[model samples]
Target chain A: MKLVVHMGVLLGVGLGLGLADMALRPLAESAENATDINDLIGQTDPDSGTPANTEPDVDTPEIRDPVDDGTGNTEPVDDGTSDNTEPVVDTPPDVPVVTSEPEFPRTTPGPNWPAHHVTVEQASQLFGRPDVLFVDARALDKFEEGHVQGAICLPLEAFHGQQPQILEFHTSMDFPIVVIYCGGGDCEESDAVRDLLMPDGYENVYVMHDGWPGWVKMGLPGETGQGEFEGFYDW
Target chain B: MGDKDSCSAGCGMTRWIALPVRVALGGVFVFAAFNKLFITNGPALFNKSIHAFKLDEYGMTEGMMTLSTHLVPWVELVAGLALILGFWLRAAATITGAMLVVFIAMYASVLLRDLNVECGCFGKLSPFCPKTVGSCHILQNATMLLMAGLLAWWGRSAISVDGMLAGKAKAPADAA
Candidate 1:
């Protein structure tokens, strides 16, 4: 009878303490903000039947500069600013004018295309690089089904809870680049993950523009099941 | 008189031997609770760890997961303190022993399913076991279970709160 009383007291105390802790430390706002996975997956582009890039193209130059008509008249054009005292001049004979676009296309700030979004081709180039880390933002079941050869799974819904682990792994590896991807076609999970990671001092986080489907479609290295922690401690 | 003396001597020896075992078991539980409850974002990390076991696949709801996440470490804390103070050694040992059994079973399930999940036994401070679940966890928990069983069977030592209280209770009975 004494043993039973002791057990009951311990249980009651534990329950009280647990409830107090829960009440004190509320769940993070991220949990409340997490979008339903089904809702995200069901969304599609009506026009192209692809993931709609509804977010405004912040990468595009909004204001175009007036082109110089090449009159070579040494006159300061009345640019709106009083600080513009010097006249615009053509390039000197010694200087060369290079007019080539960058090797890879840049993405605009949007749900489908994060500012640092990398194309499937670019991601392929960085695949074997030691400085790059791949993170799969898909659900665990999807990740277990198949994922990028060395990607770690960190689903969007679980990001708030699981971020410490990801941060620890990333910091330990000191990977310069982190490329996150989710299901292809209308999936913003990857972008959502990138947004969450940015505030944590990760400036080099990138999202794979075409996501998992694009990687598989390209016949890139993909594997099923979770990969063992390759270089770092298994934790 | 000789037989009585010998039995008393045996009981004294048992209590002395059980002291360290009780303390060690209590200390481990306290440390485990500290890691799970006091570390930065500890509860959240623990919640994730529990989810990795995929209890939802067995029909566990999100609410149940959250409740367990909150409840477990506190229970560890209470039971560990009780054992360490020797206020209720048998009861504390019983609770901790039961917990160890559940832990061993969980580890076994993980291995059987071939699931690649972190043990999360000590949060970010796993010293004895590796990060991943394996046979070693079972061994470690089994060892703790033995310690708990010993405490439950042996009861309290003379150098304990329970011992003092028992002595005080017996004094009045002897006078009567």
Candidate 2:
């Protein structure tokens, strides 16, 4: 009957496509930190399967607490600031140091969560830094409404078409610090974009954890309408 | 030429309306299924989207959710194609209608809970996609459900392959 023929073709196409998807998927390269947030924080190194202990155990210089260096001082003597007189050394080229002024107060003491998280103050400081690039992962309209002052728009919905361009551009730049964000805590687009990039060995990437809403909430500067540098984070 | 009863004005109107509805419904299914079938990481993303729905909260296992994710797209593709072709019109309409009901329920649950996530209906295609379902998503699905119901009620169309085949079969019977 005509019924049998039509059903046959329909099922054939659907099953054929589905089976092809299952079979071919394994051949593709897998992501190093796909769907794993802890990986972003350096809690578990992908290759080692153990906690990456990066803390240094060297002795730090003593603080120069001023209590009138005790020689029956009538007037306080001026100390030219600091206990250590040793000149600061420049960071080696091989090391990827994420340095910033201590602008934000920290109540908790520990290693910063790698480059995965950036506080509002830290993100603000990162502005205008030649090595830092802001990535907006929300839709183009949302990007047009408002975003970080110099952020690149890369909406997850259009990832398929725009992904190649990002991969190529970032690769050429040798992977600068990419500070990515979406609408905010409620939006998962930022995380999705980060996951997409991680497989290709982009390690310097950081998530603007608070997201764009958080930036707005903090009263940070933002730009409205289309950016001159849309899609790619040229700076 | 003497078959006026079989081609009444009411019947003509029903067939004309059914033709567009069937084709449109079929096209939507094909388009939706094509993206789900071919897009890179489509299956994985779909599985994640289903998990977002908190089906696990409803006592569904990970394995069951995984199977549904794999199977649903193919069924939609097949049913949609069948309806468009007007081959086994009644059967195809019934299947499509049932699937629409399931989709409506799923979208309704998402709306009720107020979860913010992609609908995954069109596999990242924008404009057509109701990103993070609200009233819009429910309305879209409801419209599709009505179309499916109408297709089922009409059951046949003069412009379909089903109609042509029936006419050919009747010719042989008449000659005999």
Candidate 3:
């Protein structure tokens, strides 16, 4: 009976400590945040402490002028308030937004194409389409290095969390097609990406059954995700 | 008192060491039951449990889930307390051994099936994450299985109630 009582006490202590440990986590992290900034740099709490980080704005950071002598240390000598500010002479004209209609080939099984896997030739034609929204659902780092031409990087994991902004990016397009694809055959992330835009009543959502390795192996026109936004033909 | 008393003292020391390990192992099963009870895909865990125990022929229904989870935690907690307290040591060791075999076989089936499901041992928290199809960090489980084998093979230490009572009874008989 004595032994049984001791065992019961041990069990109670273990469970009590476990619950108490969870309740103390926030308290511990907040206590850490009150320390030196450099020591507190990498401390991360999934749902807390981020907003209070704004309190570290004690030192005002320098904002530079639009044009400067190549040296970054140069002060804003082009201050507009100068008596010789000279009425803003040699000002550049506002450039008009280009609305060029680039012709692109369309795909077979055009919209709401379910489980009908596309071949390389079919994908190549789809890639050339004007309306197809190709998404590289890889890690951000992997997507940044290379992607299909006219493709955008919205990794499947990150896409789910930021769905509102993602939906708005293509809100104006009519019957827009999004071809989501991931790394390879083993990765089911392409299918996992039934994210906000798909069910938000946008028309077409097709998964590239095979992925980037497949796209590149077929010698299709491809571009790196890393470079400049404009002039991506030979990228 | 000549030979057996000396043996009993030696055995008692080992029982003290074995007690903590048994409690730890039993606690793992208790935690497993707690998760499978409340947080798991409940019907799914029952279906898997039936399959793991090779009870698939009975056609597992939703009704059995409450029974399985309830029985399992109590069994684990009782066995844990008994083993740690050196009460009914042989029975506790035997049951712990059996439980470990069940865990090993369950994970092995998961290995063969290539199911893309986390082993819901701890349910929502720290689910058994498989790195690939049909395999996990298999070595960690293999080590636990080895510990179970050790406990089963050498659980005859005499610090238990069985030894204390048996020794005194034998002493009066010898004095007679």
DockQ: which candidate is best? 1
In Å, residue A29's CA in model 3 sits off its true spot by 37
Positional deviation of residue B113's Cα in model 1 after best superposition, in angstroms: 1.0
Q: Name the regions of candidate 2 deviating beyond 4 angstroms.
A: A1-20, A24-193, A196-235, B1-10, B126-129
Q: What digit string (tens of lDDT, one per residue) describes model 3 on residues A85-172? A: 1122222333222211100111122222244333233445456567667776776667666677767766665645554455555555
Q: Ignoring the other chain, what TM-score does chain B have in each prediction?
A: 0.91, 0.90, 0.61
Could you tally the backbone clashes for each prediction? 0, 0, 0
* Candidate 1 local Cα displacement, residue A105, angstroms: 17
Sort all candidates by lDDT, best to worst: 1, 2, 3
Best model per lDDT: 1
Instruction: Tell me the spans in candidate 1 whose CA falls farther than 4 Å from its real position.
Output: A29-169, A173-235, B1-10, B172-176
Residues A1-235 of candidate 2 have per-residue lDDT tens digits of: 5445655666667667656655555312222223233333445556634234322122222222223243322232121111111111232324322222111111111133433555443455566777667888887777888888877786776556555576566556653567788764335787788776553445456666556755664456788776767544422
Off by over 4 Å in 3: A1-235, B1-13, B37-70, B127-138, B157-176
lDDT of 3 by residue, B1-176 (tens): 35355342345456556656666665665665565443324323433434344334346444454334334444555565556555555556566566657666666765666544344455334544442224453554565556555555555443555557667878998899
True contacts kept of each: 0.48, 0.20, 0.00
Pick the winner on lDDT between candidates 1 and 2: 1
Error of 3 at A228 (Å): 30
CAPRI-style quality class for the chain A–B interface of candidate 2? incorrect
Question: Which sequence of candidate numbers ranks them by TM-score, best first?
Answer: 1, 2, 3
